[model samples]
Target: MTTTRSAADDARDLPAEPTAPWILVLAGGVVLLWLGVLAWQVAVLPERVPTHFAADGRADGWSSRNGALAFSALIPLLVVLPMPVLSRLVLWAPGQINAPNKQWWTATGPRLRRFERLMREDLWLITTVTLLLLVAGQVGIVLAARSGGDAMPTWILPVALVVFLVAIGAVMARMFIGGRYAAQPDLD
Candidate 1:
């Protein structure tokens, strides 16, 4: 009997990807939502007055100003509530929602591959910025505690150290993973 190659094998050799554009859309929506939330919070809030909430859980005259900020933040969060559904809607656009589990990979794998590429190209800059931000956050925490006559709790230092180590490990792992992906482009 003669052996025959299947469609799967043919697909493996093809350079085409089957992923839907849902991730791209979802990422855009999230960015827009984040920006809208930030804008409303900064633009609508009072300048310097500290609004007081009454002891009975009611807002006094000054506290009415606080609602503007809270509502600004909450409205965006509410608007973003449909993000997951929107993502699923995008996934379904290519009739992928009812397909088998293998089809799901067919959609997400290319996106993951691209992400690995981006990580490879930007790893050094990402790592540098992340490390600087982590260092700055630690400095801020220390300064905040010291200025208030409060010593950071005994456990906090160790916890912060652990978190910093874990973050560094994650960055290293991302770099290693990206390098591995770059080395084996066919596997993707």
Candidate 2:
């Protein structure tokens, strides 16, 4: 005998995929990797530099400071690196709904639309922030070195500061444009 099912039965048959657990796992892994790298740097960096080697290790404080700044800049890159990974994981996972139903599309559509907008916004944001960090961090390292009586052949802090300011300005302009674009909700 053939059985006929109603719409309610069909919805009940549609499985809901859990996304939170995978998101949590991805976040936990990223955090743990960051902590591990930080711990390793703390534990082994001083040994290689040797505290007794120089006066307060000031012969080349720039290296340490620059390293610190570069490391800080890398944090953003590291955080963003997982986006593709998460996308892949979500794509590969079983029971994942590749497409949403009408209700979902109607309800969460705007949020998803905003998320897409933010993705475009982030490209400019990441470029600006990375460039700013690189310039400012180097300037900071140079200023620190010069302050510590370590004579560097070239003092480039002023130039670096200018570049940092320019990057900041560009970032502001891009953000303003993006905000304006996002304000007018276009149902495309």
Q: What is the C-alpha lDDT of each candidate?
A: 0.40, 0.41
- Runs in model 1 deviating more than 4 A are 1-116, 120-150, 177-181, 186-188
Number of the top lDDT candidate: 2
Question: What overall lDDT, based on C-alpha atoms, would model 2 receive against the true structure?
Answer: 0.41
Task: Give one digit per residue, the lDDT tens place, for model 1 in 79-153.
Answer: 433323333332224333232233433344343333323332333333333333333333323332333432323
TM-score of 1: 0.27
| Candidate 1, pairs of clashing residues | none
lDDT for position 13 in model 2: 42
Please report, as a residue range, the 10-residue window in candidate 2 with the lowest summed lDDT.
46-55
All candidates' TM-scores? 0.27, 0.35
Per-residue lDDT tens digits of candidate 2, residues 112-164?
33333333343434444444444343333344344445432233445555765
> 173 in model 2: Cα distance from truth in Å?
2.4
